[model samples]
Target: MLGRMGRPGLIGLAARTAVVAGTATAVSGGIASHQANKANQAAEAQAWEAQQQQAAMNAAAAQAVAAQQAAAPAPQATAGGGSDLMAQLNQLAQLHAQGILSDEEFAAGKAKLLA
Candidate 1:
């Protein structure tokens, strides 16, 4: 029994091994691809969230600038308006020191005043 059909048995064993190896490779490849896709999606979501946060910050800065401009006194026609602009700048600085304005807000306000 040990010597009978030795060659045929070896061939059958080799075929079975190949089938098992192919199946394992396909399953592993599928799992790896799925994981890669999930990681890509997570990264994209994180990037999108960061972009939205940045946009919100930009809009807030613009709003703060507009607020500062509105708060400033308009230039007078009769005399020098330098003091009026300087007073607006001082008020903005005080607001920032009191923590009423964030750093972004303070910068925006200062930019508007200088403009």
Candidate 2:
């Protein structure tokens, strides 16, 4: 009887040890997975913030370009001296002949040049 009781006690102790080790492994794995998920979430949030900042920078650059365009002077209709009226008239006549300019537009341009 003493031998049989000793055997049962040893078996029970081994089973308890196995159950404790399994529970500890499961808890540790769960904790590690939770920590990894938190880290991933943090990384994702940082990426989102960076993307927003880049978008803001791009918008600022575009606004600066628009401001520069608005502040700059417009180009002149003719590049040379303003006194060359005959040459301009001839160019207009050619454009009218080529059908690039309508009759009314040609007349208006001629009037503007004469004025």
Model number with the top TM-score = 1
Question: Best by lDDT, which number?
Answer: 1
lDDT of 1 by residue, 70-106 (tens): 7756655448867877877788898778766678878
Over 4 Å off, model 1: 1-8, 77-115
Model 2 worst lDDT window (10 residues): 1-10
Q: How many backbone clashes does candidate 1 have?
A: 0
- Scored by lDDT, model 2 comes in at 0.74
TM-score of 2: 0.59
TM-score of each: 0.62, 0.59
Where is model 2 more than 4 Å wrong at Cα? 1-8, 77-115
Error of 2 at 17 (Å): 1.2
